[model samples]
Target: MPMTVRSNCTGTLPSVIAGSAYTCSRCAEPHDGPPLGYGTPAPAYWNVEAADQPGSVLGEEQCVIAGSYFFVRARLVIPISDLDAEFDWGVWVSVSEASFERMSALWDKPERVEEPTYFGWLSTALPLYEPTTLNLKTKLHTQPIGDRPLVELEPTDHPLAVEQRTGITSARVQWIAEQILHTNPPMG
Candidate 1:
């Protein structure tokens, strides 16, 4: 199912406001406001066959597949040049068992924010990028108790990495929304 891009902005605006509404090129639905973020429900490795596999666990913030594969949900934030708010991708990253255990142990503790960043591999593939997003190197920075970890891409020449480092324009954000909205199977 496609994720609904809800309006994060407050108050109402007149439809006449230029660029206030975005018409999805694929669905033809007019989104009233810019989307602040999108997220995946589960890691790409958690396929239908893995759904009921034993020794596998999938949770809102963490996941384990076959007691070998470890994953954590994280936020990949991109600054929008023209807006105060950011564009975020709620993605998953594959971590080592040791890192996963440490994160799990500190999951409910506020002090977890003090922990060092964990090395991880991008486990979710984002849409609209030329090169596949999967397997990208990342550093997962733990946040407060209630916040998701932040996934920082390694400094590289990838378009996503460049966007994260230099920021993207509002027009780029709109283009992203359109592409993701129309993508088959939908993007998080």
Candidate 2:
């Protein structure tokens, strides 16, 4: 499945504000602003075979492959130093069956945030990061009823983790947008 990049702003590039006349390096067109979020439609482990298997399930917020491998879509938030809004990666994490069941049971409840953080492994392979952004240690933090769970990486020297901790600049966000847009064609 193709990854989806979503921008709350109306522009085509990442800029300080919407409708900014920033010329894109890739397309040379004036872009509005950067996308606030990017997401993979399924976990990295998911494939055509997995999708065809019995008992496999894939939904907007959750995934189960062969009734064994469990995944939940969560937000990996990185604060932007120069912007008021933060950047987010809509990534998936692998969790144990027990954790998946507990999360499902409380999926619609307002008190689900009271549950302790669940240990998980990052299952999305993000581009533009060296040493692959796969299998990093993470904690799935349940949010309010309407929000996706937050993915907190285990403190490490990984670039993604470091960015999450210390934040990134608007320039970095723009570079990210450029790389992603240039590489992945817009979906129909």
Candidate 3:
């Protein structure tokens, strides 16, 4: 595929929000809407309280530093189908465009794509690891100490660790940690 640096924001949004209900002058402009590329939305069940509400774009930024082409920041509302569920969480997703598109294409389709390109939860607004240290540590920690990967994450007191304890999609957190592991695996 030819990688043209063409800056155009074009993709499928929820059909429900296609018209005046969600119309914005920005949508017509390339630079105004979320950066154009492949991506997916946060899961529908990320926020249980906003069952009736739709997910909205909070912001987006190109992030070469993090290794992703772009990151779509969104406020996901995971609907509460369980009547006993007490409340919902206000969470953000830092995801790849390819992942976002997969979710978007299945917005109202009968067959939905369960997997996205990649994404991670914003367990907390605070930075869990410093940029410089994160790169080095993710590489070291994901390595195997014995039979299992070390996973000796630094600053264990960080909110991300708390998110792990609370079951806020630790898979996503692991995905982020595994980036380095996948990029540079052990040579045997």
Instruction: Name the best candidate (by lDDT).
Output: 2
TM-score of candidate 3 relative to the true fold: 0.27
Residue 88 in candidate 3 has what lDDT? 20
lDDT of 3 by residue, 78-127 (tens): 12132211112222333446654554455455444233224343421322
Q: Candidates' lDDT values, in order?
A: 0.78, 0.85, 0.27
- Count clashes in each candidate, considering only residues at least 3 apart in sequence or on different chains: 0, 5, 15
TM-score of each: 0.86, 0.91, 0.27
Q: What is the Cα-based TM-score of model 2?
A: 0.91
Candidate 2 residue-wise lDDT, 21-131, digit = tens: 467888887665666678888999999999999989999889999999999988898898887768888899999999999999999999998999999999999988898
Assess candidate 3 and give its lDDT: 0.27
RMSD of each: 4.4, 3.2, 19.8
Tens-digit lDDT string for candidate 1 (1-188)? 23434322222322122356877666788885456666777788898777678889889888899888999988898887886557777788999999999999998998999999899999988777769889999999998777788889999999999999999987787777777666744433
Comparing 1 with 2 on TM-score, the higher-scoring candidate is 2
Pairs of colliding residues, candidate 2: 11-32, 13-33, 13-34, 14-33, 14-34
